[model samples]
Target: MSAASERAAAAEGEQLARTLAVLRETSDRPLSFVTAGAFAALDEGGSEPLAADAESGTVIPANGLVLLYGDGGAGKTTLVLDMLVHLASGEPWLELVMPARPLRICLVENEGPRQLFRKKLARKLAKWPRAAETIRVLEEPWQGVSFRDEAQRDEFVEFVTAQKIDLLVAAPIARLGMQGGGTLDEVAEFADLVADVQRRAPGLAAMLVHHPNRAGQVSGAWEGFPDTTMHVQASGHGRTRILWQKLRWSSLLHGKTTHLLWADGESFTVDEREAVTASTMVDEILAAVLESPGASWTKLRPRVRGNETEKAAVRDRLIADGLLVNQTAREGQFRLWHADDPAATRSELRTGLERLPFPTPEREAAAVPVPPFQRSIGTVERERHGRPGSLVADCLICDHPFSVDDGSPAMRCRACVALTADLVTEREADQMRLLERLRVREALRGAA
Candidate 1:
């Protein structure tokens, strides 16, 4: 054949391929002619769908976007590290019943490296059921690689597809896509980028890690695109909890709390925070009380908001929720607020405070206390822990740790937990006493 004829034939073949691709995209249903049976014999094919009962923790489905967000040091990355180890080792995910298929994961962490990640993974997988060989890692060290414009996204997508990956994990979504929501176009485009990655890989899961907004919501337009969204936050230093902020297949809502604690070495597991309403108001009032013990309502209102009545309503609502109390006063001043009953009250406050309005970083930092003990193993010289008890633990509602008997259940520390019984009885007695004192004071004032 002539060289010119050979070139013409190659061109014709390229044109045919492009035409077929175009038709696939334009079709009402993509690749409709290829029946499910065609792929049935392949190992990747025809497995029973993931069980509806599989979802449990803050994470549910293994497909589409899964977001984990919180303030800095909220352990968003730590939780992701735990999940990655679970995926790599084939351990039963604490909340998920059906294990994800043996999958390849390409994760990008802007802050860490392959060696450190591998070390962490090794530590994690040592406790689980499977060998480390089944998991694959593609690390992008610099933060810039994942968010590189559309061209980079497309290229990365192509690279992932070529690898036949079953899962993709990207840490800190800001590094993976456009950061600011400056305009509607930018927001939509960011959402589209996330959705596009999912669409491009139907069988693969794309889990993006992001820091939560000051209000405790996920950041970026992509936040709304995920099939599941989770908020991992620290209720105390060295102790972090995970909550389901949203889920496509689960009934869990925002602030449905669960805890995950770091164990021996890098191992960690989930602890369910007893389900509670996501009450921002309740949180604010509790925070005010902690910031100022014996604070009066006049003073409390300002803590909720020094200048704004509308914002103060949030605090009033919290009082109505019974997360806070109005302790009657001795003089003309309004009642004071004392922490309500419940050992978990302070923990819940931590949960809510992390979600409050701007300047949240400072507020959250103030809430994280230095853990009393840091050594994972062995005896270190102990410093005197001042106070009346041997172990001082924070009231979950008020963040006040008190000494208690070692063997008792933790429910007693919080004033909120004892609300219905002992704690309420104590509060009522105090209230009556305060009211009597107020009446006597009024009589004196009238006489004067």
Candidate 2:
């Protein structure tokens, strides 16, 4: 090795040895112990193993690392603000009952400017004035405040410790910046930084808000470090759902979700929506099915436009429709496909069926009884996910999905339920057959 390289290595080794020596010299005697000590320690003190901090009934432990991540425009900012407001005010989170005593919370927004936060605060002020007073926002973060920058991290740790902050929010952690990387990549560096902070201030808990990658997973080493992970999603109509996706300490919140609505402009309100239950699943199923026609059970399962209450409603909506048929074909062991799709083989019957006009004549024919319980299953979807044309309905008999005429009572298309003057009796059927034979005989004689 070169002289300088060797010298540098020796210096690092000496520093490490000195640090170890200092730790050994200033440490408690016979410190390390086994499972018995852990058992006794647990038995001796501490109120509860873990308790909820900001979220009611949810335990966000002291010195815990939590990640609240979501898609780019999932309203993470609004949701996080609401959470902090509850934490500061000792209010229930969507009636989940937050900590009885409010914890001192600090939200350091690395992304949004002071103006944006003001706008947010102003919107929520009327409803959460008291909570707003307790929560603190740091507009200007110290330069180079990152795990990669030890000095800045140390300063932040000191700040958190001195302020007696309970929860510290680090937003868009990418802004924190990393120095270099290890074998495990950038996430390891982030974890190290967080560890350093926790060591300095044991009472300080961290909640990092981050964005998802293209594949919809939290970017970087977030999953590796945080003891708890909450997946946030925007469910449209200014509504957001924060799914407590994983928690290392507790299973009470596993698969549990909370919905938050952000109503802004002219007026502002943050409200907790009711969780989807069995009764509500039917409505959710109807809305989703309306959005996506011909969507099979497998496709509809993951497309949770609304919360899941009844698992069975996924298939029941179509089964209830009774108008549309499952032309879904199976590919190999598990994959399913739409059977009527030309991608497989275009059936002449299906083509003819789709081309037929709406059943205007069938509804007009008074003699024939209209099918009982005619559900106008709106426009036949050209492709499974294609937009529904105005007033779409399906044919009952041939299972042909068709567009219904506006204000039409007919469920079946004209082609499916052929319009005859009246329901044929046995003698009428025989007379019709005899007339057909006589016409064929005359045609043959003329040809000869």
Candidate 3:
């Protein structure tokens, strides 16, 4: 062999020997190939799904890395804290079931100070005090440890194993002292480190919180590292929506978004009503346009129930699907029409409006169905002296015409008054139901 070839062979041999030595030192059992038969014989029933609901299938995978990312002040930490609390309490979170027994968790909070974390934790524990017993927080001196440092890594593994931690939460992965500059190599190194920890402490799941890029996406190659990736965005009115951006192993939550409403300090409740299915929203939009053809977006959006972002998204989707048509009307206002309509131009729509059965303003007002109990008791008077004594006045609430004897001042009709009373009663009943639900949840927690 040539001189250079001999030197290269010797260097490769030294590197392999060092690698083998490190593996031998770190591994608890002797290294051996996992044969196909042995792998097949392994117990599959022991594996559990991470953050899953019994009915909804797998959300996140167990013993694997998961990523949660969002913009600042988007309630990412709040959501995760709630989740960990539920897991610790052995209760369900946003319908996701937890283990029957409490799971040990180590929260590495890097963004906030210890006092701030304390306040947050206190609020979360107000309802479920038992969860506090299982959760551990590691705050300061976090930067001193890095996966690249063998001693530090070993210490971390020891801590995980010693505490019997089932889950490790690293808040804002950037703060973790993983020393590479968001490169492929850095991600690979982090993944290897996580795998090592998981192997050492079986059933350990790692959740890494991260920040998105300017375009609102996972910042780097770190996206590919997690078995599941979730994105949180603020939906209006103290509510946030979580979108499953990536699910490598399971397709259960793919394309499905979960919404959470802030109920109290550090508390979130799932708003199932606001979680309207896409098909339902589409149907609502189509029906609205069918009722009021040529309605502008400004007028039609209010009739829908979703936030502005969702409304716009569904609108764009409808247009793309060719289920709805948009045309520029007078003053550049965008007018929407059902795609099945034959009206191709503004003038055509106007002409068609006259011929179509679309209800006019007066017709719509007259179409309001008045209850039999609201029939006027007074007889209609043709005229008293020179003009009719009884005049027609529209109801202040329903706009239905009612007789005003001797031109009496207009007021809400009897039917509207009854309807208003019914609405108020319904609202009170809803409030009572909500309170009952809260009480039941508290009772269940106490029982557990």
Most lDDT-accurate candidate: 3
In model 1, state the lDDT of residue 75: 64
lDDT of each: 0.53, 0.58, 0.68
Report the C-alpha lDDT of model 1 over 330-381, residue by residue, as the tens digit. Answer: 2233333444433223323442211111223234335565433211211222
lDDT of 3 by residue, 1-448 (tens): 9999997688557646755876787796766788899998888842777566556455555677888899888998888988888888877776644454577888888766668778878878888788888998875574444444455567778998898887888877776655556788777766776676777677788888888888888777786678778899989869998888877755767666878789876778877774565666788899999989877788888788766787788887877666776654232245688877765332344432212222233443454554222323233334333433344455665555554445444355434433332322445644544554453343334334
- Per-residue CA lDDT of model 2 for 1-448, tens digit only, reads 9999997688557646754875787685676667976766775322332246333334676777788889877877777777777777776665543554677777777665667667877787668778766677765653334555556677778877787777788777767664332235557756656766776787677888877777787766456577789998888877777788777766667667766666553222445456656556655554555566545556656655454445554444434344223333322111122333332222245431121222244534443565423434344333443543324344455454444434354554443333221234346645654554453343334334
What candidate 2 gets wrong by more than 4 Å, as runs, is: 1-58, 122-127, 141-144, 179-183, 264-448
TM-score of each: 0.49, 0.56, 0.60
lDDT for model 1 comes to 0.53
Candidate 1: where is the Cα deviation over 4 Å?
A: 1-63, 96-100, 113-115, 125-131, 140-144, 147-155, 182-184, 252-255, 272-448
Candidate 2: pairs in clash? 52-58, 52-59, 56-97, 56-98, 327-339, 378-392, 379-392, 379-393
Worst 10 residues of 1 by lDDT: 373-382
Q: What does the lDDT read for residue 243 in candidate 1?
A: 66
Model 3 clashes, total count: 0
